[model samples]
Target: MNKTPLNHWHREHGAKMIDFGGWEMPVSYEGILAEHHGVRQACGLFDICHMGEIEIKGAGAWEMIQSLTSNDVRRLADGQAQYSLLMNSDGYAIDDILVYRRSADHVLLCVNAANTEKDLAHLLAHARPDAQIIDLSADTALLALQGPASVDVLRRLGVELNSVPRFHTLDIAVAGVPVLFSRTGYTGEAGCELFFPAAHAVKVWELLLAAGADAHCRPIGLAARDTLRLEMGYVLYGHELSESITPLEAGLEWVIRWDAGDFLGKSHLQAQKQAGLGRQVVGLKLLEKGIPREGMNVVAADQPVGRVLSGTLSPMLQQGIATALIDRAVLSGASEFFVDIRGKMKKAQIIKPPFIQRG
Candidate 1:
């Protein structure tokens, strides 16, 4: 199994380690619920070094990325990042990535750890002779300190939060080590994702912890990470997204840039846009007692109409909630459906995504 640079620190801090994809990662430090609430009320830090970072350089980088992703990365100025998708010929999503345009000739793609090999292979297959692709996942260490109080926590590190706008970044020297601070995060709260030298990982981690002491921040794990993203309706690679699913089917049509011009999956996505997919992904908020589990059946009029993709006992809502790929035929015509949880049926309503948003 693969391990990030901070693996030793995680084990020493009493983290519950588990195999996530091909990597041995931390599931929780103190506990999942405690870490979840900590990020909600104060702040918390996450070690996201497991994510892959790929560099696209050379003069053709702009044209190369434009031909690959659904988002309009070319329009972005230097240092701007956009959330996008890498697709296959059928328009199915390979992975949802963040494209950072460092310059006209230099672009950075941050992809999921599990899909690093697949995504790199797919991109390299189509890369032009002038374009150069570099994999720097092993050398990068990513840290995230997030919450309403994150600004104050980072201020102690000499980064002014108010001046750092969203989707923007700055180079800073923290604890005498060079680091790049990006005002972005998976959590729908004000936060920054920091990338620094792998050699300085221990020092930066310790500094952030000591600075956030008054803010009551602590180390968070993958369990809380999953739950927090679910509450915000953020799509997980294997759960809400997959190789067979398109952006339109997943309610992510906004990310598709058909007006920009032809790209890899242009024709297929445009055809689906014009004709429409038979199924749609929607959020399910359980009204009755029971937690919805993945692969559970969604029934309408005593017949299975769809299947749950992701579900959980929502800590904030105090009820079970889920996201599912429901039959568009029934979803558009009906208001609610029953989830078969442990052989018992529970009622839930169909709603638009983003069940919880940050304040």
Candidate 2:
């Protein structure tokens, strides 16, 4: 199995490791519940070096990126980033990625670990002959510090917390190592994602721990990360998003740029927009006691309407919550629904996310 640069550190810290996608990652450190509360109340540290990073350079870089991604690339000025999607001809998502515009001639694409190679190949296939593309996954290491007190923790580490706006990036040195610091995160918090040399992984990790001592920050794992994102209604790649699902069907039409000129799936997306969406992703809250899981049936009026894509017992809300892709007609017409848990049907209510607002 694949392992990140901080794998040994995770094991040393007594983390329960699990195989996520193909990488051996920590599922929990102290405990999932404890880690979840830590991030919500104080702050938490995460090793996210398993994600993939790709670089595009040269005069054609801007044009090449514009033609490949769903979001308006022209709107991204220097030192800014945008959450976008890489799409296929059928309008299905190849992968959801974050595009960082370092400059007109230099850009970076951060993609999911599972789809790294696939996304890279797709980009290379459509890139112009003059565009220079390079994969920097092996050389880059990323770390995330998140939660309500995240800014205070970073300020203790000598970072100018107020200057870097959300979705913006800066190049600076932390602990004497060059770092690419981006004010972005998955956990819906005021935090920063730091990218630095792979060789400096342990040093940076140790420094962050020492710096955040007074802030009461703890090391978090994948288990809590999953729950945190679910509470925020953020989409996960394999669950809320997939190769067979289009952005409109996933309720991500906001990211689709209709007036950005020609793109990979513009024609198909335009057609769908004109015809209207047949299905949609919706949030579900269980009215009765029961935990909702993936592949569970969603029923309306004693008949199947859709299947749960991602669900969990929200640690913050203390209730069962879920996201499902159901038929648009059924979802709009029905006021209430049910989730089939084992042989029992649990009552539920359709609601818009997010289940828990960030504190």
Candidate 3:
């Protein structure tokens, strides 16, 4: 398994290590519950260095990247980022990704760890013959500080919080280390992702932890990361999306831009939008006593209606919430359904997603 430069520090800090994709990463530090709440109320630090960062440069870079994804790349300005999806030729999603427009000639794509290599090969195959693509994952380190207090913490570090607009980035020196700071995060909170050289990552992590605010900053890991995203009703790559699933079915139509023009998946997506959808992804709130797990059958009136793509006993909502795909016909009747949890069917209710929206 690949280990990040801060592997030793994670061990020293009592992080529960786990194998994620090909990288060994922390599952939690002070524990999942503690860290989850920390990120919600105060702040928590996360090591996201294992995620892939590939740079596409050269005069034809934008032309090359535009062919592979579902969204329009031409709209992105310098230092601006947009969420997009990698698609199969059939128009199904390979993964949802974030693309950073560094300049007219350079774009950076951040992909999920598991899909990094596949994403590289996929993009390289169609890249302009002369355009340059570089994988800087091995040499880079990424950390995220998230919570309501994030902006305040960054202000203490001498950054004007209001200046870094959402989806914008600043290549600035922080704590004596040159780092690329992006105003982005998976958590539905105010946050920023700091990308810096691998060697100095440990010091950066230490600085955040040492800077005390309301309820001191601490290490958060994969466990809380999963819960956090789920609460926001955000789609996970493998769970809520795959090459078999289109972004339209994943409730991600916001990311698609029709006016961007002449991109892959545009034709099929346009048809889907016009003709209406057969299935829609919706949220389920478990009213029954059982916890909903992934792939569990969702039954409506004792008959299998759909499948649960992602589910959890939400810490914030204090209820089991899940994202599921179901026939559009059942949506109105979805007020009550059964989740086949561990062989027994338990009651559930359909509701708007984001079981935990920002207050």
Candidate 4:
């Protein structure tokens, strides 16, 4: 398994390690529950070095990126970012990505760790003669400082974040280390994602933890990260999305730009939209005392309607919550359903997600 720059620190701190997307990463340190609550109540630091970063530059960069991603890149100005998807010809998701526009001639893509190589290859295969694509994953290390007190913690390190807007990037120095800092996160909290040279990972990690000591910022792990994102109804690449699933079916139509002329899967997505959808993704909250798991069958009126894609006992709500892709016909009439768990049916109610709402 591949190891991040902070692997030795995690081992020394007695973090329970696990293999995630071919990288050996911490699942927890104090515990998942503690770390999960830490981020929600105060702040938490995360080593996200394993995620991939690709840079596209040249005169043709804008045209190439506009044709590849579903979101309208023309809407992004320098130092801004937008969430987007790479789709195949059949309207299926190739991968969901973050497009960071540095300029009309330059853009950066932050891709899922597991799909880095595949995403890179996809970009290379479609490369235009004037565009140059480079894989910067190996040289870049990402760190996330998240929660309500995250800004205060950064202030302690002499980094003022008041000037940077959310979803925007700022080139700044944190404790003397130059970084590309963005006011963005997966935990649905006020925070920032810091990208810097891989060599400074250990130094930056320790610095943030020390500076955040008074605010109770602990080093979070992959397990807590999963729960945090799941609580917000954010789609995981393999679970809520895959090569077989299209963005339309995943309840991600908001990410698509109809006015953006001619993308890779535009025709197929248009056809699917015009024909109407057969299935739709929705949230489920268990009324009983059982946690839902992926692939569990969802039934209504003794008929199977869908299958759970992602589920967990929400740490904040203390209830079982999940996201499922169900038959669209059932959504109009059925507000409740049953999840078959170990041959027993558990009652669940359908609701719009971001299960735990925040201000």
Candidate 5:
């Protein structure tokens, strides 16, 4: 198993460790619920160095990127970032990714930790001979500072938070270390991701925690992170998405830009759109007190209609909420359904996503 640079630091801080995508990572520190509330109310810091960062540069980089990703690369200006997908020929997603437009000839792609190598191989296979691609994951460290108090905490670090727009990045220096700061986050909160050299990982993390101490900032772990993202209806790679599932079926049409011109899955996606969808992803709120789990049957009138993709007890809503990919016909005809939780049928209602929208 792999370990990040801060592995020892996490152990010293009494973080409960677990294997996540072949990397030993912290699942919780104080506890999952406490950490969840911390991020929502005050602030929380996360060690996200296990994620992958690949750099694509040189002439023809733009063309190479356009051919591989689903989003409109041409719309991204320098210092801007976009949420996109690395798609398969069948229009299914290989991995959902974030693209940062560093310059006209350079772009950075951040992928999930487990799909790093697969994404790299896929990009290289489709890239032109002259397009330069570099994997910077091993040499870099990433930290996510999130919450409602994130901007104020950054301000204390001497950053002008007002200057950095959402989805925009800043090339700045923090505590003598050069860093790439982006106003982005996985948690549905105002936050920033700090990328810097791996050697300074511990120093940078300690600096931020100390700087935000008075603001009630603390270290968070993956357990709360998962719950936090699920509450916002954010899609996880293996659960909400997979090689068999297309972004359109995953309720991620916002990231698909057909007018951006041809891409890897353009034809299949265009056809799917024109022909309408057979299945759709929707959010479900348990009307009763049962925590839904993945692979559980979703039934309507004593018949199974679909399966739950991802489910959890939302920390914010304090209710059992889930994202389920079900037959579109069932979604249209049935206003309510039952989740088969361990042989018992529990009442549930279909609703639009973002089960815990803040504003």
Candidate 6:
């Protein structure tokens, strides 16, 4: 199994480690509920070095990227980032990615850890000779500092991010180490994602924890991370998003640049749009006492309508919340559904997500 630079620290600190996509990652530190609530009420730090980064540089870099991704790369200015998707020819997602425009001729793609090699190969297979596509994952380390009091922690560390807008990047030095600091995060909070040299991982990790001590920030792990993102209705690669699911079906058509020129899967997506969506992803909150889990069947009028893609008992709501891919027709008129938990049907109500909205 693969190990991130912070693996030793996690083990030493008593984090319950588990295998996540072939990498040994921490599932939780103190506990999932504690970590989840900590981020909500105060702040939390996360070691995200397991994620992947790819650099596309030189002439035609923007053009190459634009042709490959669902979002409009041409719209991005330097130091800006856009949430986009790489689609296969069938208009289904290869992976959801963050496209960071470093310069006119250079772009950085932050990809999911599991799809690093697949995404790289997809880029290289269609590489333009003038555009250089390089994998930078092995050399980079990523850390996320998130939640309400995150800004206070950054200020204490001497990194004043008052001027850095969300979804934007700034090259800054923290604790004497240079980092590509971006006002971005997976958890729905005002936070930053810092990308720096692999060798500086431990230094940055320790510095963040020390600086954030007063803000009540603690190390969070994958379990809480999952619950946090799920609460925000964020799509996970294998769950809400997959090669078998199209962006339109996942309610992510907003990311598609219909006015922008041709891109991979554009034609197929256009056809799908014309035909209308047969299914859609929607949020569900259990009305009765029960927790929903993935692969559980969703029923409407006693017939299976869909299956739960991601589900958990929300720490804030104290109720079961989930995202499911169900028939679009059912959502249009149905106000309620049932998720088969074990052998019993649990009642649920359809709700638009960001289930627990933060100020």
On lDDT, the candidate that comes out on top is 6
Kindly list the per-residue Cα lDDT of model 5 for residues 115-211, writing each as its tens digit: 9999999988887877899999999999999998887889988887668898999999998999999989989988899989999999999999998
Q: Give TM-scores for every candidate, taking all chains together and pairing residue i with residue i.
A: 0.98, 0.98, 0.95, 0.98, 0.98, 0.99
lDDT of each: 0.87, 0.90, 0.85, 0.92, 0.91, 0.93
Report the lDDT tens digits of candidate 1 across residue range 1-359: 99988899999999999999989999999988899888888999999989988999999998989988898876788878888998888888899998888888998888999999999999889989989999988888889888888988988888888797788888899978888888888777788888887788878988999999999989999988887888888898888889876788888888888877768878888888889788888899899989999999998888899889999887778778899988889965666699999889899988776777677
Supply candidate 6's per-residue lDDT for 338. 97
Per-residue C-alpha lDDT of model 4 across residues 1-359, encoded as one tens digit per residue: 99999999999999999999899999999999999999999999999999999999999998999999999999999999999998777888899999999887999999999999999998998899989999999999999999999989988866676668888998888778899998889999989999999999999999999999999999999999999999999999988888867799998999999998999989999999999999988899998999999999999998899999999999998889999989999888876699988889999999898998975
Clashing pairs in 2: none
lDDT of 3 by residue, 1-359 (tens): 99988899999988889999989999998878888888999888899999989999999898877877778888788988989987766767777899999898888988898998998888877777768999988888999888878777788788866688888999889788998889999889888999898989889888877763554788899999999999999899988778766788888888777776666667888888899888878889998666788899999877888899998888887889899988888877656688998888888988888888784
Give the number of colliding residue pairs in candidate 5. 0
**Candidate 4 versus the native: TM-score?**
0.98
Worst 10-residue stretch by lDDT in candidate 3? Answer: 208-217
- Candidate 6 off by > 4 Å: none
Give the least accurate 10-residue stretch of model 1, judged by summed lDDT: 350-359
lDDT of 6 by residue, 1-359 (tens): 98999999999999999999999999999999999999999999999899999999999899999999999988889999999998778888899999999999999999999999999999999999889998999899999999989989999867666679889999989878899999999889889999999999999999899988999999999999999999999999989889887898888999999999999999999999999999989999999988999999999988899999999999999999999999988887766699999989999998889898876
Task: Count clashing pairs, candidate 3.
Answer: 0
Q: Among all windows of ten consecutive residues in candidate 4, which has the lowest summed lDDT? A: 156-165
Off by over 4 Å in 2: none
RMSD per candidate (Å) reads 1.1, 1.0, 1.6, 1.0, 1.0, 0.9
Q: Positional deviation of 66 in candidate 3, in angstroms?
A: 1.9
